[model samples]
Target chain A: ELVLTADMLVEGVHVPRHVAPADFAYKALAVNVSDLVAKGADPTLYLLTLCLPKHPEPGWLEAFTSGLSNAQADFGCSLAGGDTVSAEGPVCLSITAAGTLPAGKMIHRFSANPDDKVFVTGTIGDAAAGLALIRKEVSAHPLSGEGAMREFLLSRYFRPHPPVAAIELLRQYASAAMDISDGLVLDFTRLCAASGCGGIIEADRVPLSPAVSALLEGDAFSLEAALTGGDDYEVLFTAAPGVADAIRSAAESRGLSLHCIGSIVREPGITVVGRDGAPMQISRPGYDHF
Target chain B: ELVLTADMLVEGVHVPRHVAPADFAYKALAVNVSDLVAKGADPTLYLLTLCLPKHPEPGWLEAFTSGLSNAQADFGCSLAGGDTVSAEGPVCLSITAAGTLPAGKMIHRFSANPDDKVFVTGTIGDAAAGLALIRKEVSAHPLSGEGAMREFLLSRYFRPHPPVAAIELLRQYASAAMDISDGLVLDFTRLCAASGCGGIIEADRVPLSPAVSALLEGDAFSLEAALTGGDDYEVLFTAAPGVADAIRSAAESRGLSLHCIGSIVREPGITVVGRDGAPMQISRPGYDHF
Candidate 1:
């Protein structure tokens, strides 16, 4: 038996209340899978604990189970055992996934080194932009593809994908790695804390989808949202400088967009700079459960 | 690492609302540790997930943590990681405990023998009787020393002593086992299902505390409550009849009662018999979360 367990996601707290049931189901399992992937573990077994508000709507449970069963089939995991109970308010989904690693092969958060290259896979900030769009709060921009990108961004917010491959690949090449959950900057700060290293990230090198760029327009503050607004399940990792070529080639072969935007250093805090080397201060810190 | 996780308890569900917070604190961790003992797993780590109705009253969390810390010290376990969140209703504590099994020593529920002797450690129905006492619903009985027995029964309900020693003992001799959570009858039925076997239980042989007997008087209907009410946290197991002597002596030496009340049969359903050999109908079946 490999290390197997689960965490819970309450509806109003873990995910926003407006999320679709199907997306909620998919994201719930994906978030758990992301935990396993972060540990360089493959998902093999899962136990689902569901607390429903009422007798669940038949159609909703069907759709939710469809997403759950599909994810299990796609990931080659099996349902083991779990309990279901009634709750008075929000729906709660807790999944415990179990998987094994080869002997002596476990990656952790405290292994990054000074002088390592910091990389993130896939695009960032689209989910944040989508949230802004959903809230009807983002100002109009001069970008020509605003309409198309806005729809795409909104959809991305509903179905954030976990970068499982990027995380697994880095387990072999990266010194220390973690999935970007609480925004890139905040989570990177945590990685720094865990690894006892400092990092300097070039803001301009951060990957931005067209949707994010279109929403940002020329506003530097939009980047603050990119730095603090979470739900973009991308992999952020640090690798030795010597593996840079391999990292780029491996990501390219997988059609993953891997960006090296920062470097770890001997110091102990995170510093983010623009192209001109001016430090950027995010208006809001990362999401705090409290 | 061993798999570690926990679920929290809230007042009004696991305990009565009038119960002391201090008692609730101890019960929370004790119930979770019972799950570990059921698996014959040695406690190594714990994660506490506490949701509070409000910022806890002064010293409430402190007292809770003190109890949890004490339990950890008793079991040689330590905390790893956890999260605290706020809830609008009752406080909930969820604990995930991680434990280890020596190589090839992991116990499971699927290996019961057809003729294995069914045994349970410690007495049953005491917890249910305690609950009845708390509710002030038990019939008046004049048994001597009933007051002290009631106190002990109530304490057992409020703060179950998980059979940590029984885990090691059962691992040495038992073929299949699980902690009795949803009453002995219900949990044993589940065990039979898991092992694909049936059983014949002698009603008179089921272990009962004096308090439970006093509460029931002569009516055996209360036996159903004893057999099906949840939260006893005693270890129920099955082993070859040949080991009955060793099992009895081991439990006796430990000052714990090991009662052989049933025998797993080649058939496929649970059949309970009284002295007259008639079928007994239990009022409360095993707890069903669904």
Candidate 2:
């Protein structure tokens, strides 16, 4: 087959209006590309079905298209066809990307094994923190006059660097891998569900930016929020313990951080453990698109 | 790649609510499959993304999925993946059907010949009349019993039995072809535009169903409506004049109609002529998304 496609991105739901147009296009294509990446497919071609605001400024379109072009060039993909429509409400973009995988070699969500070391590429919770900071800046007081923290948070919320290359690399050794768009804990739960297994997650071992940590030091609930918040766009994979060293080496070779945050187990439910070994559960775990 | 993709069908756009949900899924997937058919791609997999009403009835979903399953089986495609979400307003369905094309041999839109004979695979105006009939039925009055006009219009409007097999067979000989989703005149004009040439279509040679003819006899504008109204998923192609007979013969062998609507001219614009060789123009020509 020559196509792999999916569409979905509603304004105010998948993204916010405050985001840069270029970032919107980048994240839009990235989400679709991540689906292809999860299947161990290389990006080949894409079509954009855009429901844009009427009378969009030319600069916005230029920025958006430039972002799309950059992502396309980076992944060696081409734009083939698409539809553009004027919408009266918030802008919506639905993209379908098609890629090729070796015949009979496509990876699915299922197929995991007990004792596989669960790994995550890149730091988590940045996007969630960024959104929080944006809320604070807009609704409350401006936070520190566009300093590093604000810029980092806004960038994370805007252009989520999709783990396309990392996913492609992990496809070779990992039994199951998916981008953490819908938060770590929830997505990990889904991965476990798909593979018919449970997981043993370590709370302290999970990476968090210092800014996120500084915002609420003792609020353990916030840690769960970071775990369950969507839009991180980092790759979470599972590999056998024997390959942990190799996974770390491989990820480092590509200038990516590979953290052994947890492990797969034979049980059928999630159990998150703090440093002292007691199980912990927090509310507001993740998003569900009902 | 093992994925097939397409775009969203918005309410008040793709179909009417009076139409059954079963037909909605069929039209959604069929139109997408028509694209693959034009590429000589074999349908094998599908993924659907739906933006639905707040509380869609089970009957609607069941009928929709049934229609999708039917199309998949007919085309030998599998339902591989999907995501569904509730929208704030109006229902939308995005379906991507994956199909394989011979390596490095996929057909594209920009490959028409200057001296090719133009052919359309089926009758064109039935779908437009079908939409008209649907509007009339809803606002005017329902005809008693399953009247012939009502049944005919309903079939054309709802289940647009696109000639996929005919398209598959014609792909071998046709230089450039595409499904006529946006009215005959407009779509044919697009073909000419893509091929970088002109066309002279004979108005008298344009096929119309008996119902359309009846509707047009007392109304000059109804003919224009039938000519330019959109959503006819028929194959339109151009080829060398020398191969026209063989093409017609091949179509006939498969129990399909091959209409010789006109000739691909050397000029640079689309022109339609009546029996008296007078220039023709129709109002409300084709569909524009924005």
Candidate 3:
């Protein structure tokens, strides 16, 4: 089966106005690759359309194309074609990626069983924290000033590493799968809604990077912010509980971290339980453009 | 074989800032279809990426989508998927169209032979004249004021009727094919450059709509503008002289007017001969974005 996906990123709205063009191009292509990976597809080709603002600074295009070249090599995809035009406003970039997989092997969000164990690849909320740092809403002072931790968070926002290498594992094990573009809770809620079921996430079980954990420990950040903030390109999926060990082993073999964060239930809504075993209140579900 | 092409349109750059959303949408899709048709492929699906300015006026999206729907039906293609995002500047629209043709049958602009006859579909320069009327650079007063002729030129500019229905005729007859987008002289020059040959166009043989002819007769427009104006969206192709009769009959049976405008030559430059049968010096060949 062939899988096709398109993504658009506009300056200021999607990224900071003064973002590095190399980072901008990398994130633009990575996001689309995330979509294809979530569907258990191996990305093969992509077409790019760039609407560049009038009078771009010298070397901006060179840096941007260099970034795309790096991304193409990393993702094992080629740039088939593209169009470039001058825009009167901020720069806008769009990429349409195409991939292929074995027939009937696509992982969907609506196929999770009621008793499926929810799994997510990599740590969640890192990219969101990175974005928060970029917006200056949060400080990296809690994590020992502007050091490696700060750079880590910012890099997560600029260059997302979606688990493209886990395609085979997900195809073999995941009953339902989708990338965590929106916040984990919101995206998991969507999966539940599509599958006509409910889910319960144990907050303590949610994986966090050392930087996020350090900030949480320092009382500089709230778990709620991590739960509600989006931009995490990690893959969230579900599988039968019987295959949990097998899935874990396969992920480990591929040098990937697989966390069992929640479970699917027959109930009709999503719930996040605190460490105290009480339900947590979410002020906002996720990012909504409208 | 699968064929793909992408085009980008930016407000105030590609179209007027206050242009109708329906016309904008139609032209976006039509231009991509023209590319597929020129390659002798049947457009099957398209992906649209819309970078809409923040807070678009009411009903703009509705009209844009309605235009896309109409175009999809007209072109026998469907919207596979797309992405929409808010832009910080003027609206920017990008479309990546995909088509399919039998392997080894795709037409190319670099395959023209030395003695191949050049043919163009339908009339040229009508869209360019329509654009002049839009920009108020020229007046329609010479063609009976704001009557059918006025509307005809405007419609030609807004809704380009690329010869998509002549794909089969082109595939069977043309040695080299390409859509005339960046003016007749410029695009033909590109074809000649790619084919390592030259071409000569007879000025009197270039097809012109009655509206354009009337404007020319009234001395309100120059044939040079028609030859050099872009956005014609008509197919320009070359075929061997042995199949000229077959191509003509095939185009006629399909209700298409195929005009034999010129012939490819072994020389290394393009020459346009005037009605007096002398080489005409072109002040400007075509549109150049840079």
The most accurate candidate by TM-score is 3
Candidate 3, which CAPRI tier?
A: medium
**Alpha-carbon runs more than 4 Å astray in model 2:** A1-7, A53-60, A103-105, A137-146, A218-221, B1-5, B17-19, B137-146, B218-221
* Residue-by-residue lDDT tens digits, candidate 1, A35-121: 667667777877665666557766877888887877776566877655465656667666667767766666777899999999887
Model 1 agreement with the true structure over B211-277: per-residue lDDT tens digits: 7777667452277788888889898889999999998898888887689999999888887787578
- For every candidate structure, what is the RMSD over all alpha carbons to the true structure, in angstroms? 3.5, 3.2, 1.4
Q: What DockQ do you compute for every candidate structure?
A: 0.28, 0.44, 0.77
The sequence of per-residue lDDT tens digits that candidate 3 reaches over residues A139-254 is 88889755999899988888888899889999999999999887898999999999999999999999999999988888778898888778888899999999999999999888
Reported per model, the fraction of native interface contacts reproduced equals 0.10, 0.27, 0.81
Q: Which candidate is the best by DockQ?
A: 3
Q: Give the local distance difference test score of model 3.
A: 0.90
C-alpha displacement of A53 in model 2, angstroms? 4.6
Indicate the DockQ of the complex predicted as candidate 2: 0.44
Better candidate by lDDT, 1 or 3: 3
In terms of lDDT, which candidate is stronger, 2 or 3?
Answer: 3
